[model samples]
Target chain A: MSRYLAAVVLLAGLAHPAVGAAQAAQNATLRRAQQAYDNLEYRQVLTLARAALRERLTGAERARAYELLGFTYGAMDSILKAVDAFKQVVLLDPERQLDPNRVSPKAYSAFDVALRQVLLVRQLRVDSVSFVGGQGAVPVRFTVTQPARVVARAIGSGATVVIDSGAWNGQVNLRWPARLPGGDPVPAGTYTLVVDARLGQNTFSASQPIRVSHGRVDTLPSVTSLPGYQFLPETEIPPQSWRPVGLAFLYTGGALVGTLGLESSSLGSSSKRELGLVGGAALVTGFVMMLRKPAARPAQANILYNHLLRDQIARRNQDIAKENVARRQQVQVTVAPVSPVTPK
Target chain B: MTRAALGPLLLALALRPAAGQLVAVGPQFVLADYREVASGLRYRGNGFGGALWARRNRFSVEAAVVRLSFDPVAGSAADSGFTATQVDAWVAYDVAAYASIEVGVLHRSVDPEFDAQSVGALRVGARSFYQIGPGATVVFRANYLAAPKFSGGGHAAVSLDLGLGLDVRLAGRLHGTATYAFNRMNRRTNPGGTGEIDAPIQETVARLGLALGF
Candidate 1:
């Protein structure tokens, strides 16, 4: 009996060590999953956590495994699977809560969505925008998990104005009447849409960019048409003058007077009178005609108008180009719930 | 007076319109001198005339007619003088803007009651103009006149004349013109014979007028 007891003791000691090594290998899989998660190896965490949950595990160990699965799925953008994993964690340990700081709000919100599967909340996004007068109001659509105080703020450069706010529930569509709180038409430019939904102590917010656009966004001050007279260029030739003709006639009369004087000594009274009359009349007529001159007429003014018109057309094209760039640079943003929610 | 008549007819032909044409008409006064060598008589006269001139591109036409009565010196008989009528017509080709060559005719006749002489001649002439202003021009003309014999014992006469003229614009299409001319004529009587046939005469005339154009 002593010899048989000694052999069994030695065999039991060896079996105990072998059994510990097998259990240690199983525990190491869970530990390795946690280390992979910490190292941000999400694919490895998904594989190790799934394998650990398939095996027999304590409640705490199972909850930890599901937590790892939740974060891994969330990192991979599989929100439904993440929600399912987190919900399993809650079902396993009702007293445990997810640390808000450690996970993103998206993950927390998804978890809340799974917790309250009866009421679904969707992501906020712009629904539509209209630019015509009386239809300028922008519509924002969103679905809520429950009734909540929803506030939409339109933020602009140094100017924050609440565009819409009210108590609302279910799939709600809000209209931001295209005006500031001061009842002024919104100036054309860029703006930000901030949607805040508050239910009990929980508050959620979303930010989106919005813009207002119009064909005539800028005020074009009245452009006066160019004056016709200003564009006329000076001509090289001076206007016609009749002064030389008058001077010539005057000189001719002087010569005639001198001729009559030379002929007076030899002429009879009648002859002398005839010469005097002819020469005197010529002198008088010349003096009179010398004073008369015609007025100069103006040149054609339309030539200048043609040049100015071309320049004005070019400027107008540039103005149109500037307006086009301004219009295209505008982006209209509307914020509302766009994605449909489903329980995983 | 066939040549005299033809002068006006050719002038009328040169009136054919081309790119541009000018027409002028005017009242005129003429101072005339008359001398007779055989009689040793001298006279002076005054007359009135109408002048017409037209130009079409490089061509031109002109016509004038004057009537005058000469007065004798003191102690001279009333029958020693005569009343005369003169007509002139011409056609010219402008070789340049300011120069032209012309052909014309002149007819000078006395009233039968005055028992005076009648003469007809064909004329060839050259004229030059200097433009001083718009519508103002100074003119110089020289010509030779070939006169045919019309009386028994009379031979053909040749005459030369130098004329100075002025064209003064009064207003639109209205103008005044004045001219002074010196003429010398030589006549032969009884060709191939001689009996005081080489008669030379000198005449001077001054004219003033106003013209209208269309």
Candidate 2:
């Protein structure tokens, strides 16, 4: 039963041979160390991995050497030494990760302990954003491996702007308004967002490149009229009636009565020929007019309503003009992440 | 009044370049009836005239001049006839949308000197006007003749005049006009301080014309 449990433990540790496949070593010693680790030769892995570490290697190969040493130590039941080796592995590549489901529990535990021991900022990200100046901010997120004093900054175009500074650990989120202390947006150009974490003698940083651009802020349009309101006609046609002919008859009758009453008795009755001629013409004109369409007259209520609507539209346009003027003086700011340059 | 004063006045009013001013000028055909003292002393005549009207703002002016030659009608007790020249003028101010108060003068002269009464009087009156249709109006007026002077020398206790008028715009800037007027004067004269005797005069005139509006 003891031998069977030993075989099961060896199979579990060798389950993730593909983990090192992507980092095929160019150096003969590191290649031998990786082969020995895959063969479950823990003693040979420890010797060969330590020897490969002594040789000058690429940064990736060096991290691979340390990872092999960590797994070899965990298979030999030396948890302290395994954790020490993983610490070196994470220091060489802060973003290095080991899957707990594919690796031995002991190796995964040591890797976790190594991550907790280091002071590093990992997975730094800057999300693309656009906003009117002073209205919004850019989103930034990262992870810190240990409790540390973390400072985030943007440096470019001969200027360095500090984004945030605090003592924090684990996952951290920040918002950068990308404005100056005077409430103005920064000049447009390519910039590097750098995050630094320091814990006593140990320190690590991560960086991302971002681009800032400027654009004209959209202005509001002036209104010509209000919604749901309209102007009405200022004149209306009156209804047709017999008032014209009636008035003509009344006036003619008045003239006739007055003439008859004012006649002098000595002169008897004056001739009616003059009255017959003119009064006949008046009566005819009046009768014709009564049959005609009435003329349009002023609509007082509609005129007043149209005047008020025009006033309201004028006021609205004035307000829009003022807002457009303000918008013309402001700027739109856009920020987006770009492919990073080589970090120093 | 001479034609010289009246002609220039009408010309100036027509030529004045004032906003909202209306001016109309026309020739008129006139029909008139005249009687003196007794019904038998009557004459009927036809004549010609000219009329001018101008309005600006709420004020208006109107003038008419006619010349008529008359002969006694059939069975009349008159041996001769007369020629008469009459002038009438008024200046009015609107008191309401359709009403106005006016002051004016009327003067008539006879060519035969004594064949008929030559009268002059100051007129004070009120008129009402209404628009019967598009570009059509009717007017009526009543006047109290005050301070009368007659060529034959008379004192008039009461005198009155009444008129009716019509204007229709027949076409662009062209108008048709018609007017009728009647006046009566009650005069008492003491010839050589003999006794008071009644001598009254009455006349009726009709005018029809076409006016050019500006």
Candidate 3:
């Protein structure tokens, strides 16, 4: 009985080796698939990989099978199927890499496409907002997965201005003139900068807000102080139909007439002479007045007006500060690159 | 009024209805000091006046009239003062946001013909402005004035006007304007002309006014 038991144990060990051999044989399908892909027998590689996937393979083995399937499909120009297979490879072992020496450039490029299709990521950035001369412009930057059509629009309170529209590829940098198509400065207000990119049937868009400040028009009472003067000085007043010299001439003529009247029968010679002297004095005074200009008073009013103006300026500065705060609140600018939205 | 005097008023009225035009009118306070070499007299006074300014795009017209009374000076036997009026029109071309070059015509008159002075001139100038704060600007201007025998005396003169000014917003379309200017008038002596006895004059003017926009 002991001899029989020893022989049976040896047979059991042999049976264990047979089971291991069967498992090894089953794993060989993935290895064969890899070899087939190397030999350029893409159809055979697909068949072997499919069979290996059907069985319960180890994680590493499953990844290798998927990689082989992807390469085979790519070689056959079956891009979508190859992409689908490559996705599986990544799912199994994300750290896998196809050897550059062994893989064709086209296959690698197709794999890249597959990766982007599976995880779409794109971004748009508003590089800057600036002005040239009096014309304003904005700079935009974006990365493209492929060739695409790009359009930018600046929307303002009363108008929608299209800044850019064209086909582009790769990394794109564009400068958009901040005026309407008609080449007029946009009216002042808050504006939205929107960028849209179309890649085949996919569309992506982003927006940011900016402020355009032309000078503001105000309509308040004047801050300048009024002068306290019964009448403006001759030097400071505007031209008039009547002048001081003319009045002087009239006064002198009236004095001469009074002297003449005194010279007539009713007045004594002494009175007449006195009247004549008065007329002569009046004439001389009028002539002097005509020759001499009228001087003005001191400029106290101007000093007061300037003081008021300075106060107004200080107050306006405060108002501007408040306006700046409000403008900051209105301007919602985002410059960070954003993750791409999945296509519907 | 003479045609020359009426021309500016008519132009302002016409432009008042136009779009993008600004018209401002207000009372002004003025302080001025003047020195005449021939008379060896120094005249100084303060006065009130009115100013009108019309602006459209790069073009502008400004007019001001003031009356000034002088203190009794030793050289003159009588008190001397005069009403002065000025009108100017200019077009400005901007080279930068804060600077501009301008060319214009100016007309000036002094009542009672003090020293037989004439004021018509061709003006060339430059102006610069800086925004120190919101609704406020500090402005500087310099101009070369060439008068080519505009006075009947057949005497030509050249002058310079240097100005510093400030504009402060008061309310909607209303602003306060304050300016200080220095003027140097150099008269050319005609060899045997009776009016040639006058000497160069240096004047300083300070003005403050309210400006309104239409």
Candidate 4:
């Protein structure tokens, strides 16, 4: 039974997109670590983001994606993954060594300072929301992306909330309507938004989202908040497929041009000259034919279904390349390697 | 009200601000022009685009003009630059989002300039209309017309006019319009410019002007 159980589990995992699923799982884990960093849970963000790096990525995209991942960890006071992700980005593009965009001494010093704070916070043992402060008994709200309940209570005399976490990296917020009429209502003081959820319990909880500064903005009748923004999903692009595609096209076009220029049956000097002439014509014709054919669609949908632009296609040919990729998941070869660089 | 057409228009009208509609009026500028080496010239055109509404903005009235002008350029020097003009109007009221029981003296005959057979294009008019509704605004319209307007006898005559108009906005501020008219005469290929003895005229002229807010 145990053997069958293991086999069943393995089969189930494989039946799904085993590799893509694993990569996606790793992505989700790193994202949560980023969330932890945003919540100022430095230690947890580092551990989680590091565990995510175990998955495979096809190319430089992985390196760059992880670079940002490391930054989040570092900002939350995790030093190691910050160094690792940044190093990977630089490795992906060795030009980073000479590139001014890649700062070395400054980033290293900043990481060191953050790492020291992680220790200082660990020693202090005081739960705190780092980037918020205001006055009066402030009502709070949480727009949590995950399913977890959070409870908050004033801890210190000035109204602070002590965060408890079985998982060091957790997000939670305290929420309520704008005002509480009774006298025992929340008083004016500095407060911390904390999380208290078990490790491995992937749900998110919120103790508070924003700290109250003054009742002025909150009490305004016509105040409206801007809509929250999130990044579109990252799509995987296959590497080095264009070179072979171009080569195949070039060979095909050359053959056509040769057919147009010369009579293949003749072996005389006249035939040789004729061959070059017809070959040139054949190539030109082939080039024209290529241009006449509709362009290929981008492999990834780049389709944000809910977005208006995704639905608005003023032209019909936009979907061709996508359809072609679907029909023939074939090899790609580039005949001419054209770089984005241009000479001044 | 057909279930297909009535549903969208009503939905659009309902979402708008329910404000007391206001009245509107403006001079119709008609511009028509045609060039020819032929001597006796004639031109005819009449059209206008403007609207008025009652309180609540649910009601509206739109109008246009019909005009024609001609002159014997080859014969009488006094009749060379002759001109004439005409105007007509159309109006409608809100029946529902899907359907509006609208009627006008001279209303929009070609509904959808894009797809001629327009569905319930629950769309708003130009800025001049009462923009109470956050409706589907289809303000900038480019209508192309090419057809014969007046023709009789053995010789064929044709006319064409392209006009642009603005609808009422939510605030009921300003409305704008521009009209261009044209006409052509075809006399069975007389290569020698001297064959025309009759004086039936064909000509073209245009008017360019705009309506402003107070």
Best by DockQ: 2
RMSD of 1: 21.6
Assess candidate 3 and give its lDDT.
Answer: 0.57
Worst 10 residues of 1 chain B by lDDT: B12-21
Over 4 Å off, model 1: A1-344, B1-21, B26-29, B75-78, B113-115, B131-136, B147-158, B169-174, B190-193
How many residue pairs clash in each candidate at the backbone level? Answer: 10, 0, 28, 88
Regions more than 4 Å wrong, model 3 = A1-344, B1-21, B69-79, B114-116, B148-157, B191-198
Residue A82's lDDT within candidate 4 is 63
Model 4 agreement with the true structure over B57-162: per-residue lDDT tens digits: 6665544443434333233223344333333333455565423443322112221231111111122222111111121111111111222222222332321121
**Model 2: which residue pairs collide?**
none
Cα-based RMSD of the predictions, in order? Answer: 21.6, 9.0, 26.3, 34.8
Per residue, candidate 1 scores C-alpha lDDT tens digits across B78-125 of 446777788888899999977899999877787654344466778898
Error of 3 at B205 (Å): 1.4
lDDT of 3 by residue, B19-98 (tens): 35377777777766655444445555667777777766665556666665545346543466555565555566666767
DockQ of each: 0.06, 0.65, 0.01, 0.01
Candidate ordering by DockQ (highest first):
2, 1, 3, 4
Could you give candidate 2's per-residue lDDT for residues B99-151 as a string of tens digits? 99999999999989999989999999999999988878999999988988988
Indicate the DockQ of the complex predicted as candidate 1: 0.06
Model 3 DockQ vs. reference: 0.01
lDDT at B169, model 2: 79
A230-273 in candidate 1: lDDT tens per residue?
44542333344544445445444444443443332222222333
How high is the lDDT of residue B92 in model 4? 53
**Predicted chain B of candidate 4, TM-score versus the true chain B:** 0.35
The lDDT of each candidate is 0.62, 0.87, 0.57, 0.34
